[model samples]
Structures are given as structure tokens and as C-alpha cells.
Target: MEEIDKTFREAVADGRIHGAVLIAKDLTGKVDFSRSYGVRSLREEDPEKRPPMVADTPMRVASCSKFLTSIMVLKCVEMGLANLNGGLEKLLPEVAGLKVLTGFDDAGNPIEREPKSPVLLNSGLCYTLTFPLLQQYRKWQGLEIEQGYDNLDQNFKYPLLFDPGTKWAYGPSLDWCSRVIKRASGLSAEEFLQEHIVEPLGIDSDNMTFELQKHPNMQARRGDMTFRGGHTFTAESSSPGTGVLQYRDEEYWHEDIEPHGGQGIYTSPESYAKVLWSILSNDGKLLKPETRELLFKRALTLEAEKSFDEYCEQFKAFVPGVPVPAEIKHSHSLGGMLTLEDCDGDRWRQEGNLSWSGLPNIMWNIDKRAGMCTIWAFHMKPWGDPICIELGTKFEKAAFMMLKQ
Candidate 1:
């Protein structure tokens, strides 16, 4: 493990990973080991070195916040607070007015759709925020958004490409789920998380919110991501395809916005590792196996007829992330993307394996075969290096490797 850790640090030492933390847990919830690498912040605010990336230091964990929202939503479902099959028109009458923008008709004219199905409570459980619908909704009602959250929007008030179940778009759908969580449980996203997920699980509080006080080294920074073919993805707030290169827009930091369930939370390697430990074991203290099993199962699978329309078209409107292959078993669990096969970079689908990552770069993997899991994290990317991904793959493989040994 020491050798693995040393190699991981070396792989990212070129300042690509700024800092990182890793946690390995066996099936029984026993943490085999924990460690932190690099300084607390690249800015290194302290004259002294970073405190070990332990359970305490809050890390900006991007979209990892979705998993917590997933849990809260699931809890509401388990308690029979919300029905999984009802459409959005029923659950959220406000969205009854959304329209669909299918590219164009045969004559290169715009095609407007009346939506085959309304968004559903379960659909919101999956993050499928889209752009055309966002804009259209705002126009329909003269809407204006305050935060990247809750029932109101200058951004999300538009129509959707397809009604809820038909399309699959990746986004702040957690924002929608946040609304469902509030409606179903009579609790806000933050409150539901604190009461049900965080407090009960004994999770550290700092890593759960967005907009922490700026720390020199650890603060997230925006960066330019030059993809495969000279395509550069850039944004300070939210990229359509790629995630937070850095997340410090004044509006983002200052507003008393609703929880940015997609990318607002913070975490340290140690604290998130504990979450992995809890989920992997079901803790007997948190969720029963039945509830956890539901969490692992696919809440949503990409529909064969409209895969591209859902992922590449509507969802990737701006950032432009590639569509995961059909062979790649990607499911929408409350915890975000679930893997059914081993996704070693280009291919991330692992058969019967359920897992996902937080924004920038934080991953949680559960191998059903191994009946074990691991957790890992780093601040943000676009550091002119791919060390975080590189190191994560290495350490994750190493952790799994040791189990066989």
C-alpha cells in the first residue's frame, strides 16, 4: 500500500492533482488504510505544510453531492412519501407548461414537441437538466432564476426535449430531485441531508456544502480543457459536458441559493471514504440491505430509441461529453451513474457493478463480484496534467489488487 501510495503521488506530483486522498475498505466496513497526498491547497495558505488530507478538511467534491440527494430521495420513497411512476405534470404542476425542441424538421425548420410524457418524480431522481427546455420554460412564464436550485428558475423554467422517462440528460437534475425531496419529505435538500443522511451516518459536516471560505491552495479554479480535437471546454459556473474546471463565480459563491446538488458540496478524502465504507457495508446503522440494493440498482437506463437525443443533444448542449456506449451498462441510481462493467477510461461500464464520480474528480466504485468498494478524490482538473485520473486508476486498481492477494 505504501508503494502504491508513493507511486500515486509521483504520478500526479507535477501539480496536476494539487492534492488527493484515498480510502480502502473491506466488505466488512473495516478501513484497511487511509492517506493524503500533496499540500492542503496548491496556494498553500499555511506557511506550514497541509494537514494530512484526513477526515476533517473540507474538500470541494463537485457533483458528489448528488449521491447525498439520492439518498434523501430514496429515503422518501422508502417511506412512501413519493411515487416513482407518476409524471411531473402530476407531481410538479409548474412544469406542465414545458415544450420540447427536437432539432429541426426536414426543411431545416425548428420542430416543437408537446412532450410525450410529463417529468416524473422518479425521473427527477436521475439528473437530466437540459438547455433548450431550460430556456423555453423561462420564456413561457417570464421566469428568472435565483440560484442553481429549487422550483424557480431563470434557467430551468424551459421545456424538455422529451418528457421525463424518454430522454436522458446529465445535469443539475439534482436540482429537480432537490425539489422532489422537499415535496416528498416536507424537508429542503440541505435539511433532509443533514437530518437523514449526514447526521445519522456520522458524516463530517464541512464536506457537504458549496461556497466554503476561500482557502488559497484548495480553492477550486476554472481551467481550459482542450479535448481530443482542439475542442476547448471552458466555464466558471457549469459546463454542459465537462464539470467544474473551477467553481468560484461571484454569483455562485455569494447567493443564498438552494443547494447546488450537482456541484456544490465539499469533502476530504477521509470523510468521503467513510461514506463509501457506510454504503459498502450498509452499516446496519444507516440503510438496510433492501434500501441499499435499491440504491445500487438502475433507476434509469438510456432508452435505445433516443440515446443520442437524450445524452448528446439536450444534456451536452454546452460541455459536450460523449455518450456512454450501449454496451456500457450505465444506470441512474440515486448515487449518480452506476457502472455495470469495468470502465477503464474509454469503457467505464462494469457488469453488475454500480458506481459513479463526483464533479472535477472524485470516484466511488462498488464491485458486486468483490462485494467491496473504494473511494478517491482530488480538487479540480485543467491543471495541464491528468494526474488525478491517472493516480485514481492506479490506486483503485491497487486497492482491488490487494484484496485478491
Candidate 2:
């Protein structure tokens, strides 16, 4: 444990990361190790003037939000409010009639068409819908460039890339799932989480809130974003794909629309670790044993798994700064990525371990077999930056080694 702590502190000292919070725990809910390093934000003019990072420091967990969203949807399933195999047409009527984006025409306009089959609620959670939604939201807000998408109706009107359940593409499908939860439960996503997950778990409300602006305490503790360029950090926000410089304006922190289920939640490492611990222990207090089992089990079919692998391969080139390891064999579960087999040399996670990462380098994993769950969070941009990858890998290796002792 001491050695793992040393490695993390050294990484911050060496300027590899702005700051990070890590939490590792055993099956009994005892914390095996936990630590925070560096500043909460490098946006300050003087590095020495920055606030110190702490366990309770709030951060946008990015796609890590998917895990919570998935659980809530499953909770609705448990309450008999939803069907896993049901098609979206009945649950989310707006999305049921939507088309998919096929390709671009000679004029560089999107070629859209209808899907051959309906999108199941189960498969919808794993697909990508965020980018198109964002584009549409900007248009609805009256932004001129890239305008025209109005609501869920227009945002999801693109043609399907492939039949749903046949393949997987990462998108805003979970956000739509959140919408379904809202409709079925008669509560907002934030309200449902507060009444169910947050309150029941005894987690601090400020620690895991959907509304950062409403929670002033969390806002004060929010970490600033950084990129890989220098030892010194800047407060500027950059668009995910395009290198366009943008401010972390009102839209960045607060959305007038319903909370995004896929990527909008903000939380701390300690707060989220509690949720993971519950899964590792398989306590029936929240989800039944059978439902918990589904989270770590392989949910993708053989054909879909192959498609996911190819999709990941194409995405690797777009990310700069780090090389994504190709040795890891993975399958998708309802909760996150399930490790199918051990990599040739990489043993960061045991086989059957469920893991996933957020867009800003935040990552977490639950290794039920190993009696451990872990999270690594840093407010950094360009998700696949090599520095973040290397730091995260080092942290995992150190954690497993500590467990062995």
C-alpha cells in the first residue's frame, strides 16, 4: 500500500497528471487503500495557489455516469416498471420512430434512413446518441452553425448504422434510458437517484449530485479540466473531437433540459466507491443477486462482440497522446465492460472483472472474484491521452500488487 501511494504521489510530482483521487476496497467494505494527489485545479495563475485535491473533491465522472444510469434502469425493471427485452416504441415513443445516420452525401450532408428492426431498451443503453443530441440541443438553443436539430424527434432521426441488437456503438442511448425512467417512475432522474440510490446508500448528497449549480458545496470543490501539453495547467475547455476552444459556460455545467443520463453526473471517488462496494458484496439490499450477476456477465452476442472490437480499433487512432493496449479482450455487460480473458502480459484485472472509463480519464472496476473494486479519477481532456492511460495502468498494477500482499 505504501509503495502504491508513493507511485501516485510521484506521478503528480513528475507532472504526468494535474491531480487524481483513487479508492480501493475489499469485499467486507473495508477500504484497502485510498489517496488523493496534487491540486483540485491547475487553473490558478500560481501553481502553489491551487486548492489541494481531496477525497471529497467533486468531478464530472463523464461516461462513468453510465453505471449509475444503468442501475436505475435496472431498478425500474426490478419494480416491474420496465421490460429489458421491450422495444423503445412503447417506452420512449419519441425515439421509437427515429432513424439512424447512414452516411454523408456529395454535399457533405447526412444521409438518414429508417432502421430495419426496432431498438430494444436493453441494446439502446449501450449505443451512441450523445453527439447528435448535443448538435440538436445547440440548434434548439438557436446557435446558427450546426443548427437544425430541435428535440428528441429531430435529434434521433438519423438512419441506423446497423440493426439494433446486431451490433453496439457507444452513444447517448443511456440518456434516452433516463428519459424512460423519468416517464415510468413519475420522477426526474435526479429525483429517482436521490430517493433510491443516494439516500439509501447513506452517501453525502453533495458528494454525488446531478445538479452542480444547485449544490454550492460541490461547485466549490469542483476540479478544473486539463490537457497534456505542459506541467502548468490552463482553465480552457476544448470540444471533444474538434480542437475548438470554448468556455465552460452555463451549458457546460448546467443543462436546462433533463439531466443527461449518459454523461452528466458529477461525483467524488469515495462516493462512487460505495456503489461499487455494494455490487462486489452482492448485497440484495439494492439489486437482487440475479440482477447483480447480469452486470458482470457477458451481455453482448458473439457477432456484436466482434463489431465492438472493430469499432474500438477504429476509435484508437482519433485519440492522441497514448496508445490504447490491444491485448485486452473485452465484452459488454449491462453495467460496463466485462474482461473476457487475461491479456498476454497485462494482469491489471482478473478475468470476468467488470470495468469502464469516463471521457475525462475517470475509470472504475469491480472484480468480485478478487474481492476488490477500484476507481481512478483525474479531470483531464481527450479521453485516450497516453499520459492518462499510462498513469491509470500504473495505478491498477500497483493496486493488484498491494492486494497480493
Candidate 3:
């Protein structure tokens, strides 16, 4: 652990890692150890400069929020507020008649549009909002929109990419799911999540909600040519990558939608570790143990091999089927990108490990096989460059070694 910590610190000192929170848990999913590294800002420093890199500073841990959002939705499922196949129609009356987008033409135009038939509740959980989903979603935002949510209204030609069950193109699915939960539970997504998951787990805003309000400023970072070659920072929120970005600053939190529920979450090593424990433990607080099992299990598709290639070129996710239960097959689980296979063959191959990475390079991996969850976060530019790969792999090996001990 010392060697791992030293290298991680050295990387931060050398401008290799931006900011991170790292944790390694035992087989029971208890985070026996957790550590955070680096400052939220990535600026270079001089001898007289005061630099801060620590666990106290809050951060907007992008896509990692998906698990929390998903869990909150599932809790609704457990409480009988939502059925796996029923939420869409109940949440959005207009969505029942939506035309799923198929593709865009040569000029970047949506090409195919057809009525989405027999949609699954999980599909809406992924970001399939119709006028009803959007209109009812206002409860989550607390503002009545003159119009409903649409990535691009009247862009039916933008197409559905592929039939819902036939492919996995990650987009605004989770946002739509948030709306579904809001409509079904008759509570704003934030309030519902707080009452059911956040408060129960003791998770708080920690200024992340505040930062998002400032949008384009709060949670903003500037790129550079180097430590000395200054770069003009951009003022914008809403990450295009993985659709997991948010535009919020201190002022944004004041708004009803500050938490945004999509990503703007300020998490810590201990807090996030608790979430990993809940999901893996299935302790009956968040979701039933069996429900948690289904989450980690593959939810890809029947023809994932053939269709996924068409949807994405990188990572190339595959459903290898379930290794946990005879009746369960993990082949369809889309919990997290299988960005990692093995840390060096000396460690686990990352199978059955549900996890995600924050833009600042905070990465987590869960090994259901060992009931262990490891998270490492760092603030650095080019978030997922080779530096993260090497360090992330080393971190995984170290965590596994800790469990072995």
C-alpha cells in the first residue's frame, strides 16, 4: 500500500494525475481503507505557491453518479412504485407513441424513425422521455417547462440508433429514467433519492450542488500547453463524453435542479465506499439482495456481439454471461464500461466488477467474486490517458493484494 500510495503521490506531484479518491475494501465489501489524492485544480505551482490536494475538497464526479441514480430508481421498483415494464406509460403518456431513432444520414441527419413498440421500463430508465416524461419530470426540477425535454425536438430523423433491445448506445437514457422515477413516485427525483438513498447512506451535497449552480465556472477547468504555457479555459457545462457532464456552479445549487441528478455529485472516499457496500451487500436498505445481483449482471442484449460493434468502436463491451449464478447471466449487464480486463494478469481480469471513472481520473472497480470494491481518484488532464491506465492497473493490483493479506 505504501508503494502504491507513493507512486500515486509522485504522479500528482509530477502533473501526471489530476485528483482522485482511492479505496480498497475487504471481501465483505467493507472499505477497510480509503485515500484521496491531488487538488481539484490542475494548475502548475511554484515554490511559494500554496497547493491543496486532499479528501475534504468536493468534486463533480461525472458519470459515476449513474449508479446512484439507477439505485434510486430501483428503490422505487422495490417499493412497488415502479414496475420494470410499466413506468414509461405511467410517467409519459406521449412516449408510448414515440418513434425510436435508427440512424443519421450521410450529412449527419437522422434517417430512420419508427414507432417504438413494446418499450421496456429499463429503456425509459436509460433516457427515453416523451412529452409526458418531460412534463412530469418538472416535479424533479420544480419548474414547469413550456416545453418538455428533448435532446433535439422534432429531430425524429436523428433516429433511435437501433431498436431499443437490439443495441446499446449510451445517451440521454439516464436522464429519461430520472423523469420516469419522478413521475411514478409522485416525488421529485432529488427528494426521493435523498429520502431513500442519500440520507439513509448519509450522503450529502457537500457543495457539489452549490458548484453546479455557477455553471461554466463552478466545476470548470482550464487546459494548458504546459505548467507555463497558459491555456484559455472554456466556460461550459454538460459533458459530451458519455453524456455525463453538468453545467453547475455555486449559484446553480440554489436552483431546484442544482443537483441536476445527472452528474453533479460531490462524493468522498467513505461515502462512495458505502454505496459500493450497499450495492454489493444487498443489505436490504437500498435494494433487495437479489435485485442488486440483477444490476451487476449483464443487461446488454441478445445479439450484443453483433449490434454493439455497430453502436461503438471502442471498449467493445461484450456480455460474457454470468459467473455468479447458474440461472443468472451477466452477459447483458451494462453497469459500467468494461474498460479494464486485467491489471497485468497478476491481478483479477476485472470480471463481474461494476465500476466507473470520473473525469479527474477517479476510477472504481467491484469484484463480486471477492465481494471487494476498489476506487482511485486523481485530478489530471487528458483524464483517461495512458497515465491513468498504468496507475489504475497498479492500484487494482494493490487493492487485490490488500485483500489477500
Count of residue pairs whose backbone atoms collide, per candidate: 29, 15, 43
| TM-score versus the correct structure, for each prediction | 0.74, 0.84, 0.71
The candidate, 1 or 3, that scores higher on TM-score is: 1
Candidate 1 lDDT (Cα, 0 to 1):
0.55
**Could you say which candidate leads in lDDT?**
2
Per-residue alpha-carbon lDDT of candidate 2 for residues 1-405, written as tens digits (9 for 90 to 100): 676678778877877667888888876444477889988876676877989998888888878888999999989988899888777667787777756665556765566677777777756322322245435433443454221232343334334556777886775677677788888899988988887778878888898867777888888887777655432112222422223211132245554345777777888888898899888888765688988787987888898888667666665532111222544566788898776775323345777878877867788888876778888887776566556667777777677666655
RMSD, every candidate, angstroms = 6.3, 5.0, 8.6
Candidate 3 residue-wise lDDT, 1-405, digit = tens: 899879978976775555556777765543377676655443444423424545544454555676677777777777887776552666654555456544445665434456454556454222222223433333334544432323223211122434567655444455455666777788866667667776777666442231344434433321111111111111121221122122122322244342334454555555667778767666777777877776776666567534444433332221111111122222435355442244334355345566665544556667776677766655332344345557877777777766555
Lowest summed lDDT across 10 adjacent residues in model 3 is found at: 226-235
TM-score of 2: 0.84
Flag the better candidate by lDDT, 1 or 3: 1
lDDT of 2: 0.70
* Residues 1-405, model 1: lDDT tens digits: 878777867744643444566777777443386776754443334536434444455655656676766766677777888766655555567665656666655664556677666566545222222354344434445554223443244445444565666655665566566777777778777777767766776764554544344333333422211121122222222422333222232344334455555566655666666666677777755566788787777766457224533443333322221223334445566565555556554223245565666544567766665656777766554321234556776777677666656
Candidate 2 lDDT for residue 328? 56
